[model samples]
Target: MAEKTLAGKTVEVTGEGYLVNKEDWSKEIAAELAKEDGIDLTEKHYEVLDYLRKEQAAGTTLTIRKVGKSGITDIKGLYQLFPGGPLKLSSKYAGIPKPASCV
Candidate 1:
């Protein structure tokens, strides 16, 4: 399958939401995305990524409050990290087929 692009793509809302275009996912873009999601893009951001990956591995849904409780500190961080919020970020980066709750 062709790699996906996170820039203009809409985020999924279910399952493991990993980014489709892992190859196209650049550090700069990641940072920009993080900024868009309102995250500072620090080691803390990795916590969110790790959580999403883990949730995917376990086949579960990732909630924003749960993510924030996981150490995100700021709940509104989603606004910056994901323009579409938790569902979007999780689905976009988790690589899930397509989040049902993203819309």
Candidate 2:
């Protein structure tokens, strides 16, 4: 485990940098995290992040296809929104665990 200062608040994180405690997550923190990745989150990005958090709390097995079917965005849009690593990056910014689907 490691600690990171996001939004000026110290939070625990996995070795890969995903938040260890979802309760510590905030919109400001998400903004900070996204900024580090060079992404400027829009309302659509928030929608996707919110969706991911909710589903993760519900213990749903997350995947790009599942997120695509979420009515938030399609596969193409998810790609455009996240670019390099869609599910991996979104889950990270969402303050959720890295999905098993991601390498």
Which ten contiguous residues of candidate 1 have the minimum total lDDT?
Answer: 9-18
- The reply for model 1, stretches above 4 Å from the true place, is 4-40
Q: What is the Å distance of residue 86 in model 2 from its true position?
A: 0.5
Q: What is the lDDT of residue 17 in candidate 2?
A: 83
Candidate 2 wrongly placed segments (more than 4 Å): none
lDDT of 2 by residue, 7-97 (tens): 9899999988899999999999999999999999999999999999999999899999999999999999999999999999999999999
Residue 79 in candidate 1, Cα distance off native in Å: 2.6
Q: Assess candidate 1 and give its lDDT.
A: 0.54
State the RMSD for candidate 2: 0.7
lDDT score, residue 101, model 1?
58
Top TM-score model: 2
Residue 28 in model 2: lDDT: 94
